[model samples]
Target: MKISAVRGVKDILPEEVWKWQFIESASRRIMENFGFSEIRIPVFEYTELFARSIGQGTDIVEKEMYTFQDSKGESLSLRPEGTAGVVRACIDHHRLQPDSVSKLYYTGPMFRHERPQKGRYRQFYQIGAEVFGTDNPWVDAEILSMLHLLFEQLGISGTVLQINSLGCTECRPVYRKALQKFLRNEQASLCTDCRRRTAGNPLRVLDCKRPDCKEATQSAPSVLASLCRDCMAHFEMVKGTLDLMGVPYEVNERLVRGLDYYTRTTFEILTDQLGSQNAVAAGGRYDGLVEQLGGRPTPAIGFALGMERLAALLPEETNHSRAKPLYLAPLGDAAMERMPLLLHQLRARGIPVDTDYLGKSLKSQMRQADRIGAAYVGILGEDELNDGVILLRNMETKAQTKVPLEGFVDQIAETLAGEGA
Candidate 1:
């Protein structure tokens, strides 16, 4: 029996991976320019790490996480999101002790067991940035601005920023009670999942997508309306900073992100290009996550964008642009025997070069080179070997030139550099 890939997992084949590389590279460049350093954490961690940091009441901890016990009886789970792990790393490594602000960016796969759709996958890749050690709304605005600049650099169109404040610790309790009371009056109209959330995390019920549940919660009290004085001030400052940065955004009062840890300053970058799964990136402030993860009381904010969704936004041709290869086609058995040395020489010079090892005919090798989109083909035949020279052919214009063997590498390097290859 032929085995197929498990459902909801995707294979990003070589033909399509350039898009992912482009997105990742662009994201990293942008983050670096914004003074964010890269941080890498393990794919799996103690299950309770997420349970505590993400809050047990949320769907990620309660339902979607890929949790299991190892043979040693230690319960572990593949991270379902990036923020919890980043926060865990920050606290564990004492990244906040000396600095007033710590900025970090990470890219990796996160696992979940949800029913996958257009942009959602069981094992998906995310590129995220987080800022710890400060609660200033200016930091929040910077995060948003960074996100905007990244998408703009990627040439993604039709993105809209949806912003909201979930209220801080001071006023969320008041909103929670009011939200619960409002949910109770329309209990019958809510979906089963939303009804369950009403008891555990009532704010999450507002984020439910079920049609009946959405309509039922339309009249539910907004957290924005109940923000305490401090939260109100912070929200205004975030807005003012965003305006100063010229970042356009819309106030989405009901945009309580699905995560339970989020408190205040929730935002999502939405695009209609991807059907029902339109949110390309989303995150918010989590003032209590560090404490929950066994650290001192700390405040943090960040955002995570799925690589798959971002790749979908990329143009097909841009994603398919082949990497330039220097094809080394040696004609005759003697030339083939010396091929390895030639390849090594090119590689030592930091050239991306490739050659067929299957002993194909020169014509077949050239055809293969064209198929792989090699930028230049090096022809080393018996005649060229006797003359201590190599024929370098420009694949684009079919132009050929003979260079002495000793100067061949330098000539190739000069041509590629001049062409911006």
Candidate 2:
């Protein structure tokens, strides 16, 4: 019998993991600069947490979630998205105090049982950020700028920003009624799932990917047309800020994001490079989410991007400068005994160094070192050990030098510090 990986999952091999490291590191640095702190939530949570926060009618709750019952008969689910979990954490921890704003970021795997494609996976990684306790549009603009800066820093080009206004509680009900009436007229032309959405979350019908549903929704009432006075003012402010910052965007009225918690100032960063799944990152405001999760009425905005998609868009050879080891190859049993001490000395000075424990011949050790791409190879033989000296061979140029072991660590440190390695 043979065992293979689950159908929609993939392993990140060593060759591909550096791209992940680069993306994650870049995300952390950018978030830190924007005054957002890191927040980590559990991989699984009570099933009710999602149903209430993401809305029972949304596709994520109705179809994609990985939910099950624990031994105690309590239902649990692997998180399908980041916002619901973040809202739960904020409410549970009381981070939404009356007057202060809280900015937080999270990175982890999200599970969804969906058909996999080139840039889509059943289990994927997401880097998300959420800000609580402010209704100001500047905060929304700042989040957008931060996401823009991240893509720019990564050298990821050809991305366009699509912005929209879903309106707040004051206007959404009016639009929902109008949208339902329009969908009712086109019911026969809609897909089965969209017909259900018309009854549950009519707004989600606009986001459906089915060709028939897309056609049916093309003439549906736009949420923008129904924006109340307060919502219109807020939307104008967000747009004005983006213009001042010179961030290019388009007002896309049909872009109702997949999740149900969002409200006002929604946006997505898209690139044509990735074929059907072109959205690299997306997010928007959710002013009512905190209150719905049992906290006080707190206004929040945030976004999340798939790490895998971001990595795939990155140039294949972008992160080739990561620091590696200075290999130490001891040629004889006598020199091998002193290898540990030498390695310790180099390590103490903060030098990344490595040596093989297997009793391989000198030629084999050198070959292994070369394969690992070591910066330099230090050859220690019986004579060199007795004479208190070691030989250094530059891997790139194949140049050699001999130095006394008494001050070897300091000498190597100075050389590396001076960029002579």
Candidate 3:
């Protein structure tokens, strides 16, 4: 019986992994440059954690989550997103003290049981960043600027940044009520999901992708129009700061993100290259989530980008070229005995080196080296060993240099360093 991978999951083969690594490393570099440290949260958490943080009415909590019960009769679930688990960790560790700020980023796989399509997978990876303990709109703009810098550095073009305000606790209800009332009148035109959301989470109905729902809600009450004095001013400052930082964005009044925890400002980076799944990255302020999850009242905002989607958009030229490893080929048993020590000595000096232990012929070994993209091949045959020398061949230029065995390790290191320089 041929056992295959389960459906909805994908194996990222070696050929495709460079794209993923390039995106991840670029994200890490941009994040660290902005003073954000990396945090690794668990892949699964107590079911109630997600239920409490992400509202029970949200699609993730209601349908997409992968939930199961343990032997102890406790329900746990694989995380569908990173924010809830990150917030849980911060509160659990008492990292969110009054007047303290923490900037954290996480990258890992999130599990959901939805039907996978072009960039969506059951086990998908995300690179996300979060900032806590600051309500200042400057932080919002700074993070957006950081994202702009990341995409610019990654050479990913054709992305549009859309921003919106979801209003705070004090003013959201007013908008929600008005939007709900408008949706109730157009209930016949909405999809089944939008119809159910109309009463419980009416704001979500406006975000529905159904053509009918979009057309029906074309005149729906805008959340931006309903923002209170404070929320409006905060949003204004966010936009002003973004302008001052030279980050281009459009104010999208209907851009309420999928998560229920989101409060004031919301934003998404959209690319038309991906069909219906246009949002490559999305996030917003979730100021109330900390308190909602048993922590002191805190203000925070963050965003996450889908790894698969971003990888797909990356061009071939975006991958940073890497120095190839040096391949070691030994011709005879006597030469093989000396090669291991030489390899160990060379590696201790920080050279990327590899060898084939199967004792293949010189021609076969050279082919293997070429197949692995080796830049240089060090041949230690019995003749060279007898002469106290090793024949080093530059695979790219086909240049051969005879390195003396007495101080061959240092000589090879110097040679590589010179070439690199």
- Against the true structure, what is every candidate's RMSD? 2.3, 2.0, 1.7
TM-score of 3: 0.95
Clashes of 2: 0
Off by over 4 Å in 1: 210-212, 319-323, 386-388, 414-420
Per-prediction count of colliding residue pairs?
A: 0, 0, 0
Among these predicted structures, which one has the highest TM-score? 3
* Winner on TM-score (2 vs 3): 3
lDDT by residue (1-421, candidate 1, tens digit) is 9999998999999877888899999999999999999999999999998888777777788899998999999999999999988988888888766348888999999999999899989999999999888899999999999999998989887899999999977799889998899998898999888888888878878878788998898788878889999999999999999999999999988787877788889999998988899999999999888888878888899999989999999866564464598999988888899888878887898889999888889899999999888999999999999999989899999999998888888888888888886
**Model 3, runs deviating above 4 Å:** none
Residue 317 shift from truth in candidate 1, angstroms: 3.8
How big is the positional error of residue 111 in model 3, measured in Å on the Cα after superposition?
0.8
lDDT of 1 at 347: 87
lDDT of each: 0.89, 0.89, 0.92
TM-scores of the models, in the order given: 0.92, 0.94, 0.95
lDDT by residue for model 3 (1-421), tens: 9999998999999888898888888899999999999999999999999998888877889999999999998999999999999999999999999998999999999998998898889999999999999999999999999999999988999999999999999999988988888999999999999999888878878888889999999999889989999999999999999999899999988887777899999999999998888999999999999999999999999999999999988987765667788999998898888877888998999888999899999999999999888988999998898898989999989999898889888987888898873
